[model samples]
Target: MTENEREIVRRITDVLEKMASGRKPSRIEYTETDAPDDSTLMELEAKVVELNNLYAESYRFILDLARGKLNGDPPPHNNFVTPFKQLQSELRHLTWQIEQIAAGDLDQMVYFSGDFSRAINQMIDDLREREELRQQLADSNHAKDKLFSIIAHDLRNPFNAIVGFSEMMVQMVNMASPADLKQFAEMIHTSAKQTYNLLLNLLEWSRVQTGRIDVKPMEGDLALLIRTNVNISSITAEPKQIQIYYDGGDSYPVTTDAAIFNTILRNLISNAIKYTPERGEIRISVDTNNRFYYISVHDTGMGMSEEDVQKLFRLDVIHTTNGTNQEKGTGLGLILCKEFVTMLGGDIYVESEKGKGSTFTFSIPK
Candidate 1:
């Protein structure tokens, strides 16, 4: 073969070798016309030999063509380069697949026939998991923002009343008569009680959110606890002529938190006293089954619709209703009652009609 023909064959064979090797061909250095320096040429030959080993397993025909071109050997009789050409096409396809995956296209599920494909697929799966976790965290933050927003807006009214009423009563005491002073004192006491109850509920609810209200089971008399709270709350009820009664004389005892038991009674009795008209009646009763110790407080007062009962215990919301004698309610007592009852392994439920009355029933394990 002539020198020009040999050079052409070498260039074509170089392209074929790169196609089989699954790598881009480096720029060819073809300036020397004479046989190259033995040492430098031998180094290049060693590299080609290393490639030849890979080509023997992957593309023997391409390696044979490259060697034949370098030696100025005759071309193949049939000129068939079909199999090597197909290998080059597959290499181009793999390069495009890598570029697509890098550009955020992970929909293609690469078959794990080789180590290279498996490594790339694993990387894609890791990226997808991180993206999903990021989205979930963003959603959680959004929900927290909404909760705090509701809490801030709803808490403002009760706080304003407590502060305003406290300051006003202090100023009025100096100029008032004994009778007027007594009324003012009562107003101040009621406002202070409301403020204190609000704070207590807020603290308890925070504890509940932090998983602190663990129910320590103990035995206690449910009826006696109810009667004691009713007696204590009677001072507030008497002035308005609200009569309180207990339907069950039986001293039923149950395993629960006694402190929370007192809190539930105080809140319910207070609510009954606040909402009932003068000369109205409130009733207390205890009933039990195999599974539960049920206590109920029923009042013939200004009752609520289904909607008001539904929102009764929500901490991030505020609701209020006026007493018959224009008594103010901060709405925190019912929320506190609900939380305390729940902590004692109990559930609270309410039943009411708009015009007739309201009943709050709670049950704890017997």
Candidate 2:
């Protein structure tokens, strides 16, 4: 080799050694005066520089990916970067799935290979189970609170009235007129009746919560059931002169749980009588579709606001108001009605406007 050839070979060896030692190598420039052997060395130097440039590009891309920077310039489309491009695509898709999971979509799943896929899928399943348990806990707590409220306040109030009126009656028996004695007896009877009804509802609600009540559907006369409930409710309505009008024929057939149906009707009729003013009217009507029977109990009474109507039949909220004669309530009856209706394969709803009357409608499979 000539002196120029040796010099070119030495420079290329230095660059190669630096690159091998993990250091940035100095660039080798082409010269004007070169032998054939020097030209071959220069070509070898150009190949080395090209390889180093490609290495640097790949290194930067890998570093960015390691740092979780997904928006950086992508690596060149070569054999060296093919695996990295696939990894980046997977990471982008994983980011979207994580976002969806955070936004309450627990249906997301990762299908990547190995431990990462197993861990992520397990995490999603655990989150969904935890959310369902949380909702159930909330419902249970609401039910507990409602039960305590009724027992502490509603149950106690009627007992107090019963005790006080009976005591007054015993003390006034000798000196009081027949009319005054009759009034006291009536007051005591009303309080006792209220207590009885509250206890019945409390027992029913407890059974419902414990899943003890079973539905027994049998063919029965719907008109006769309505007449019985209305006749029973009239005793309470007579005092206020509020009339109940039901004109269904002698017999209308339905397949339903008779006890549940009776309870629902009794509650609706009693609620109407409680809310209706003196001389107001209550109308019971029934309509039928091919699949269901729609029973409507409409009352001319002081109605509710849109907001108050929305609060009905929810255990989380307690809504109650005094009747026309200052009768007290715990709002449990409506909740029981909702539960029983649902149990009987029916849905109940109400429509009311402020100052106008309310119509409560429930549907039963015919």
| lDDT scores of the candidates, listed in order | 0.70, 0.86
In model 2, the runs with Cα more than 4 Å from the true position are: 1-52, 67-71, 76-82, 99-107, 247-252
**lDDT, candidate 2, residue 50?**
66
Predicted candidate 2 versus true structure: per-residue lDDT over 1-366, tens digit per residue: 888777767766776777689764344454534555566666776676666656556767767888998766675654566688788888888888989999999999888877999998999999999999999999989999999999899889989988898888889889999999899888888888888988899899899999999999999988888888889888879999999999566777898998999899989888888888999999999888898888999999988999999999999998899898888898999999999999999999999977778999999998
Using TM-score as the measure, the top candidate is: 2
In candidate 1, which residue ranges exceed 4 Å CA deviation? 1-176
How many angstroms is residue 137 displaced in model 1 relative to the true structure, after the best TM-score fit? 10
lDDT per residue for candidate 1 within 269-366, as digits (tens), equals: 88988888888999998888998988899999999988888878764455777788876665667766877887777899999988788999988888
Report the lDDT of model 2 for residue 284. 94
- Candidate 1, pairs of clashing residues: none
TM of each candidate vs. truth: 0.55, 0.81
TM-score of 1: 0.55
